[model samples]
Target: MRREAVLKQSGCRHYRSQPTHGIGRYKHLLPPEPDPKKKDKLPRKEIKPSSDHEYGVLNLQVSGYNMILVEHYSQYVHNLCSRLSIKVQECYAKPTKTKEVMLMQEHSTKMFLDAMLTTHERVVQVTGLSSTMAPILMEVLMMNQPEGVQLLVKEHTEADYQVRFKGRPELENLVASMS
Candidate 1:
């Protein structure tokens, strides 16, 4: 009672302590960060990539059905290979009504498609694949798709490069005018 009277007379209020609610109260939960300082005066050793540490991409084409469905299916296949400890990278087509491979920009697009087959790379070498693992990859891809969705898979190779690079010659004039 006396404490209450003294508080009232002094115009001071008692507040109950709380753990935290908003960011302000919770700031102290983490240790205060160390202030930035100068770097250590020692040079670090560098490790080079050996043949065993290298990787390569498996070029595939997913088409003959809904573009959206095919892209998802391709991603599904790539993901399945990764889970099985198989090294795989993906190249997918965007949603287009006519099942055409639309080019966003040649320079960037080629890196994911046309260039994969041509480049003689240490980390991304190209390899020809037969039915050893292809059937399993396709079956896994189909299981993930809807019953109505149909997909076609084929190995993209140098044979298809000219066809894509040539593009729609007739539309060339129209495309150039827009740019």
Candidate 2:
């Protein structure tokens, strides 16, 4: 009975007034007007890592001496990229005349090279060649070595700390020994 009396005395139902749009308030509720300039804006160019640049044949005449030029390039990369790790992923696969074979080999070599470079947590692909195009290849790779480089030397195996960068020659030797 007390609850019923309190409810009767209280007049709270339907007391709130409907909201009206104030000055400039209606614009907030409407869809945004399209900008003609923004609709025609040019697409932004993608900034990929320097190592991710397309592999190109580079011919550099670094004072006509290839090895010296390569050493200089290597030193430059090492000095410049103090923060990033630098490594050389030397690829020594035999050359194939066939386009398909060459492309596939190049692709595979690059993938392996990338993996080896990544092991050091570096950021460049240093593809080297000791062929007629050696100088050119060195130049190209050096150009791409902004952050650092993985020197992928082709057709040369010198045993110091390593034979090849990924040590394919060493692996071959082990396999042959096992056989």
Candidate 3:
């Protein structure tokens, strides 16, 4: 009785009737159709290297559980590049990452933190490296790599720069709107 009274006051005619099967019954609640004449935005293009070398810029990322070992190895790589006459653009330390290991107790429903491992990372940027010299550098670095240390070498792109920083979409939108 109260529902019908409220519905009648709100000017609803089909308060107790079954819903219709046709799409027109809910057309007012559906989103408006997009304009077919409007053109969609295209993705931004990435900058390409101009040189003929395999990679215009190479990043040697070294990471390890031991901070001292990771730092020393990165320094060694920088020195080795200088000895090989490769231009070392920059050497910088990346932020340290920590991971927690959790273990479940026997016959228990709770989990506890067993250990925490912290990893340190460093990157050595080398520019103007030739295809022939890259292999030699990799071979030497791998042979001398310390225990528990990981090394990765790849071409540096704009994505690498973006990954180093945190994303702030609101700030980006504000800047775009201001421009």
What order do candidates take by lDDT, descending?
Answer: 3, 1, 2
lDDT of 2 by residue, 42-161 (tens): 343222222233323221211112334444655554443332322233212221112122223543555222221112222122332224444554575567654332455322212311
Off by over 4 Å in 3: 1-54, 166-179
Preferred candidate (lDDT higher): 2 or 3: 3
Q: For model 1, how does the per-residue alpha-carbon lDDT over 92-157 read when each residue is reduced to its tens digit?
A: 243233322334664564522222111110111123333455566567766776554555543344
TM-score between model 3 and native: 0.64
- Clashing residue pairs found in predicted model 2: 58-136, 59-136, 88-151
In candidate 1, which residue pairs get closer than 3 Å at backbone N, Cα or C atoms, i.e. clash?
Answer: none
Clashes of each: 0, 3, 0
Candidate lDDT scores, in order, read: 0.46, 0.37, 0.84
Give the root-mean-square deviation of each candidate in angstroms.
16.2, 21.4, 19.4
Question: Residue 128: error of model 2 in Å?
Answer: 23
**On TM-score, who's better, 1 or 2?**
1
Best candidate (score: lDDT): 3
Looking at model 1, residue 3 earns an lDDT score of 81
lDDT of 3 by residue, 34-88 (tens): 9999967644434446376656877899999999999999999999999999999
Once model 2 is optimally superposed onto the true structure by TM-score, how far is the C-alpha of residue 102 displaced, in angstroms? 21
